[model samples]
Target: MSKERAQRRAEREREAAVLAAAKAAEAERHERREARRRAVASRLPKKRRGPSGVLADRRRTQTRLLVLAFLVLNVLVWLASGDWAVRILALVLTALVGPLVHILMTKN
Candidate 1:
């Protein structure tokens, strides 16, 4: 009975040692990764945009999404109508939109 108890205790100790070693290795790896990330980040310049700049970026993104939706809808319209006029209109609008958005974004 005593021998069995000693064997069980030794087994538990071995498992505990293995778990501790794994944990230490994981921590070391995490630390190394964090150090590398910090080093890389330090090498890059930070881009700090003000409130209006942020708002403009947001607006630009919204405009792009809107323009994309418009183009898609117009394409569908052209496809459905199977008309040359519809295709030409869609093409003209799509061509003008990006520059128009850029102009509008830049002016404000």
Candidate 2:
């Protein structure tokens, strides 16, 4: 009875050691992967993050506003006018506004 108890205790210790070793290996692997990811990220080009970034964000907002305005204008034109010529004219003008605004905004 005493010998059987001793054998069971030894078996449990062996299993615990095996589990601890597996956990240690997994932690090491995770650290290695994180290190590799950081190294790769460090090599990438940094994004613009100052006044230029602010200007870019502002420009994007302006562009979206322009698009929304043009969309609303086109919808109103189509809804208010029954003439095909007027609708086509509004579509053409809306298409031209995007490129013209882009050109004006990009001028330095």
List ranges where model 2 is wrong by over 4 Å.
13-52
Supply the global lDDT for candidate 2: 0.89
lDDT of 1 by residue, 31-96 (tens): 999999999999999989745887778877877886777778787978788788888887787678
Candidate 2: which pairs clash?
none
In model 1, pairs of residues that clash are none
Per-residue alpha-carbon lDDT of model 2 for 12-64, expressed as tens digits? Answer: 99999999999999999999999999999999997766555877788778778
**Local distance difference test values of all predictions, in order:** 0.83, 0.89
Please report, as a residue range, the 10-residue window in candidate 1 with the lowest summed lDDT: 99-108
lDDT of 1 at 92: 83
